[model samples]
Target: MNTFSRRRFLQAAGAAGALALGAAACGGDSGSGSGTGGASALTWWDHQLQLQPAKKRIFEKFAKAPGGMPVDYTFNNPEKLGQALQLAKQSNQLPDVHSNAGLQVPAPQLINEGWMAPLELSSEAVANLKDVLLDGIHIFDGKVYSFPIFDYHVYTNVTWFNTKVAEQAGLDPSAPPTTYDTFRAAARAVQSKGGGAAPWTWNIGMTERTADQLNYLAQAAGFEGNTGMLFKNGEFAYHDDAYVDSLDFLLSLKKDKLMMAGSESWVDTDARGRWSAGAACYYFDGPWCPGVVLSAAPQFAESLGVAPILTPSGGAVRTYHGPQSGDYWLTPKSKHAEAANKLLSDYFTTPDYSVEVANTMSQPPRDLDAVEKSTAHAEYKKLIGWFRDTVFLAPTPVVKNVAITKVQVETKPVEPNLGTIIQGAFTGDVPDVKAALKKLSDDSSAERERAIKAAQAKGAEVSLDDYAFPDWKPGADYTLDQYK
Candidate 1:
């Protein structure tokens, strides 16, 4: 929707900036059980989600004097997590640990099928993770399941805008559109300004994007639907009238041409590019988006304006943000489970280590002291305040059967690609709203059934109710109002 370059951020931001730090992993032949003080050789399978500098810094930190047992580390693209896990299971060579896409699709299923071992956290550990892990994300049967790994925390409909565009459109560059009325009006004003540039960029094309867009709208409607894959339960309902109304509202914006034509196909990176280049007046995104923009287009930094999402009813949905995974350390089904435990325990609890990790990755650490030292810590402090004060950080849902979930999405393809799905619905591509919704519902239900059958074949007992989490019925007995 918006066309910006990423090269600028790459050149300006320290190569080491925004690096992701992970637990010390031990693996490979050089690492033997001979080391008593450290973990034996254990391989850590990671999806290299960070830029080069961050990765190098992280490896350098772990490149110690072969600490008792050398931990072999490796990183791959995130999409490989599932395939890699499957291959590992078949080969019996699963890494000592790996990251999971928490609270989405397959994660919950895997957890339910006992594919993951519950984390047995001590009182101290639990306290250490309070903010990062939150109370609801990691607990299972009153016991800690997965260690909260990370979260992609932020609010919905909120984006980083180009001050230049705002000024040209007769909007105050310094102020954000705090209410939906103002926001919509600004969109029209930007359009009226009539530059080749667009007023807004959206990511509503795919099922995931569509879902997220709808979720944000639902939240705006004062409904609490979780955007994460594990979205289920009483806090939010998928089939509520508000859910449909929110979709309708968004479609209205599309019909009015206030949003970009290709809103759906654009991913997070694409959206940032558009904003960084001053291609649009506004770009809907989270806080991390600003970092990405600043890194890629520092020249546009002064022109960028950040704000929270606006609600049509004048109600605000507190921003929801977190590390992508929420802080997880899995005990690989290995003979070295004990050593793995020790390394992870030391890694997470080490105040100094946490500080370094947080600083390197440009993230807020779970540890209070560590978080205080981050380079971006001050801004993160503001973000944390936003989370604590202005935002309600909802616990992302974790679904069961991640693999089956993947198959479902691919099989039940969205119309004209993901972007078209959103644009089409809103632009009158599919005039019949009820029919389109029914199609979506039917696809989702079929996918769920497929997942159920697959789990059953694996000797897993998963009920439909358990599968549908964070989702609530509109006028039904269960509603998000209870939590508020």
Candidate 2:
């Protein structure tokens, strides 16, 4: 593996300019919810069914309860949920219950825009949530806006290697590579032993998924805190040395021939299928990857081995184990807020329902005890162990400049897609990484200033100060208190 210093990266980029100020804008939802088809039918929407079967039995039980409101669930892909919600909010036809996609829009923004309803959990329900979920994620400002069911102790940075392939390549599955150099060596080894197989495969074609994987690698390559558009002292640190080094590392993978050919055309599902079919030696993903493999090739399930994402020697082994609120929330337009709340309360508060969701989804439940007692497949236990061993509960803070949120809400810009930029570098479409990053930095800063002004005009408390994290040291533990 190749290495570059932060000093060198910054020296190559030259100096950044000052930020420009602008104004904020506000909007309102004009539609109202239509009641359920039946007297107590409650409409629900989520993306979980894309991967697993809906809990029809559980829903049936809830519907059978005395004065129970039957749930009319509509399962859509999580990727499409944000867009669907935007359309629903426009016509005032939001569902009674919905899942929030954190990446598309921050949960706090939804609450600020009055798209989400405030949840009022019972004392016991609150305690259960407090024990299982990360408190910092659910509560925005000072109030709770969402309740998360799945807790990703480990994010999408893990390397899932084929143990059989490793053994065939004279590599030890027990001691997988934990550094870029060793990982590259192992990849080369697998390549040498290949029978029409590639050493590694990834979803390089999908910009969002590509960005996700690259961000994790960026963290490993000394891009200390945030993955994309680093901010510090109220300035966008887009051309930072660490960021440039990350892009350089990604380019090195392509130059070294470690990445599989045709990766640039592989979406996540295609890559996952190829990995499961043993067409590649390595797949980078989260714990949920095994479920995909098991579904596609059950016999190869036992051949898989999991490892924490590799970092440079002597670098901090920090994982992106922050609380992602893939939570269910009551929409503001819902006519049956009380019924929706009761349904969610019953679903999560019940031990069986919680365990069922976790087991079926092959994820770690908020209720730790429920996980311990779950009758899930043994592979799930291994995944849970991976989470416990590698996940960093707290690390350096990645302060979100409120401007980014405001920009996302108002206009979805194509420039922030770092994946496309990285892909361009690999394809030789972007010859100068520094120049691209500099341009991105300037554009993002301008957008941030505009958002700040717009938000201020609308009486929103957003400023450069809100995005500043002055005392944050790289690799230091950042508890919830630091955020406050």
Q: Per-prediction TM-score, please?
A: 0.63, 0.77
Candidate 1: tens digits of C-alpha lDDT, residues 97-134: 55542113333345544455555444555445453332
On the 0 to 100 scale, the lDDT of residue 325 in model 2 is 53
Query: Which model scores highest in TM-score?
Result: 2
Q: Global lDDT for candidate 2?
A: 0.60
Number of the predicted model whose lDDT against the real structure is largest: 2
Residue 3's lDDT in candidate 1: 12
For residue 442, give model 1's deviation from the true position in Å. Answer: 8.4
| lDDT scores in order | 0.48, 0.60
Q: Residue 293 error for model 1, in Å?
A: 3.4
